[model samples]
Target: MKPWLLLGRAQPPGGGAELLLYQRDSEFSLKADNQELMNSRVYGSEEAMARLGCQNLGKRPGARVLIGGLGMGYSVRTALDTLGEDARVVVAELVPEVAEWNRGVLAELAGRPLDDRRTELHETDVAELIMAARGDYDAILLDVDNGAEAMVREGNNWLYSLPGLTAAHGALRRGGVLAVWSAVPQPAFVKRLRRAGFGVDEVKVRAHGRSSRKGGAHHVVWVAKRG
Candidate 1:
């Protein structure tokens, strides 16, 4: 088979994989292996959106957020729901197409993540945003570039590295939260979160499938509070 330009992909029910095909910039869907595409959360699921309210200290005011890697917009949608009107959110997406694809085909799948008025989409690397926004955000979410281990791109390694983690540390306000998503548990990444001066809480969040009164599938969502 020819290497078609895939716009988006996800693992469907019963471990089946689905690919959003793109030809001449038009999006289509086809079945593929689970390993072929990137992983994202269910936009409308309660479990995936839980972090929004849990991390928000209070309904008082003055909460600002910066989200790195606007995967399917589930995180952003979740954040918007939890935050107050005073809150400001900046969503940095490295690949504009990912953001575009979300609208093109996966719009309903991922939800219209960029449609929210409170959300700002930046067509740039999250690292640059991390570096630029020192002590500017109350929450920072890294929901892009595969898991923390990184499979899609190499530069994402910096976000999980010592310096990268440190930059994230600087981007948050006091008691701010740095919520990171990973497909599997990363021990060293946990340690690095602590080393970066964050009171880390590693949340074992299952995928959207098994999410119920109990829990979902197997995944990691690191909630690190700025110290």
Candidate 2:
């Protein structure tokens, strides 16, 4: 068995726990306080989050999308592949080191999504972008924390609250979608999405790729469409 080598460490802005990066051969991992936040190997749900969110946006002219997290860059890359050439993807990442890692050692993991001409990187909180926009994005994808539970950053809780959901609802264009990634199912959050005037669909996806026989753990992705 190969050992995981520590690659880099960083502290997220606004005072949260420290983030650590590790590598084992071609695989990479981003962790916080001994808990794995994201791994390069298991990202099926992340890709699915973008796919399901933007499923209705195929070839839409001048479509705009916003991705809340840049973990391993799978969601952004998947989004870029899913949308049309005229689409624009805005990725908001709170941690500067995470963005740097995606550019450096982790670039190829998701085919260097940040380098895509359609991608615009924002080293700021996704909530700020969400609150500041009104019908600006055709789709919004959020993979910021483990789930609505907020594992890494306490400030992320607002992203799941009723107010946050309402803000997200306003940030999208008519008939736009908001897809959220979670480590576990959140039934109460589903109710909140509906309360915020969204039509919600809860999807369960395997953590690993379909080719993997083991059928890794199941993660939940909530695809909420603004009505």
Candidate 3:
């Protein structure tokens, strides 16, 4: 086994926790405050998030999708796989270095999904994108901060807040889906989704894959649809 090398550090906008990039052999990881934010090894739930969200979309022509986090580009790439070529994916990342990392060190790990012409990279907050667009996107996927509870950035809370849920609801077109990834179950957040006018469905997925890992750890993906 090779040792993990620290690539670089990036701070989230508004002075939140600093994200550290590490690489070991062929794998890459992003960590913050001693917590593992994302790793290249485990991305099944992320892929599932995009799959279920787009699958619920039901073949909308020229579909436009917004992905909240780039994290190894798993969600974005899986979304591209599920949606047709006409589909456009807008990825909003809070840290600029994350985009660069995706284009650089983490490029091959995610098969360079950002390089695709159908994808647009936004070096800004996802919440801003959600607030700016009204009924524009067919699907919105959030793969941020250890799930909705968030252990990385403070501002991320708004994405799972009541007002944030309302904004996400407002940002989607009729029949659009809002998908969120979390490492643990959040019953309160489920109720919040309902209050935001979304028909919610909670799916349990393993971090490694569809089944529980050796420690019985599983992740939750909330697929909420509007109208």
Candidate 4:
């Protein structure tokens, strides 16, 4: 059996906690204070985050997408694979070192997604990006902070708040999809989506691929559509 080796540590700009990156043979993981945040091997839900949103757009040329949380670049790669040639994917990563990890050690994990010409990397908060844009994106995929529950960063709760949900609604084009990945279900969030003028649908996906449930935990992704 191979042991997990610590690759590096990153200090989040928010200045609350430190993120530790570890590698175990071919797989990698990001954790904070010994709490597992994201794992490279269990990315089915992350891929679903992009798939469920981009599928709503249906190969639209020049579709613009915003992905929050560049964990291992799974969602970004999935979006690139799901969208058309002219589509642009803007990935907002709060932690700078995560991007460096993707470009360096973890590049091959998601097929070096950041290297794609259609993809842009923003070393900023996704909330700020959502607030700054108006009807700008065809889809907004958020796999940040274990979803609406908000574990990694205390400030990430804003992304799931009523105002944040409203910002996401305003940031999307008409009929655009806002996909969110969560470690657990929050019924209040479903209601907030409706209050924010989004038609919401929820899907439960295994952390590992559908072929097997590596663990019993099932992650949920909320596909909220703006009209």
In terms of TM-score, the best-performing candidate is: 2
Kindly report which residue pairs in candidate 2 clash with one another.
Answer: none
Candidate 3 residue lDDT tens string, 19-91: 9999898888899867899998888889888888899453778999999889789999889888887889999
lDDT for each candidate structure = 0.66, 0.91, 0.89, 0.89
Model 3 alpha-carbon drift over 4 Å, by segment: 56-58, 210-216
Task: Estimate the Cα RMSD of every predicted model relative to the unseen true structure.
Answer: 6.8, 1.1, 1.9, 1.6
Off by over 4 Å in 2: none
Where does candidate 1 clash, by residue pair? 206-217, 207-217
Cα lDDT over the full model 2: 0.91
* C-alpha lDDT (0 to 100) for residue 105 of candidate 4: 91
Report the lDDT tens digits of candidate 4 across residue range 109-160: 8899999999999999899999999999999999878768667688888888
Which ten-residue region of model 2 has the weakest summed lDDT? 207-216
Off by over 4 Å in 1: 1-54, 57-60, 209-216
Compare the candidates by lDDT and give the number of the best one. 2
Candidate 3 contains a number of clashing pairs equal to 0
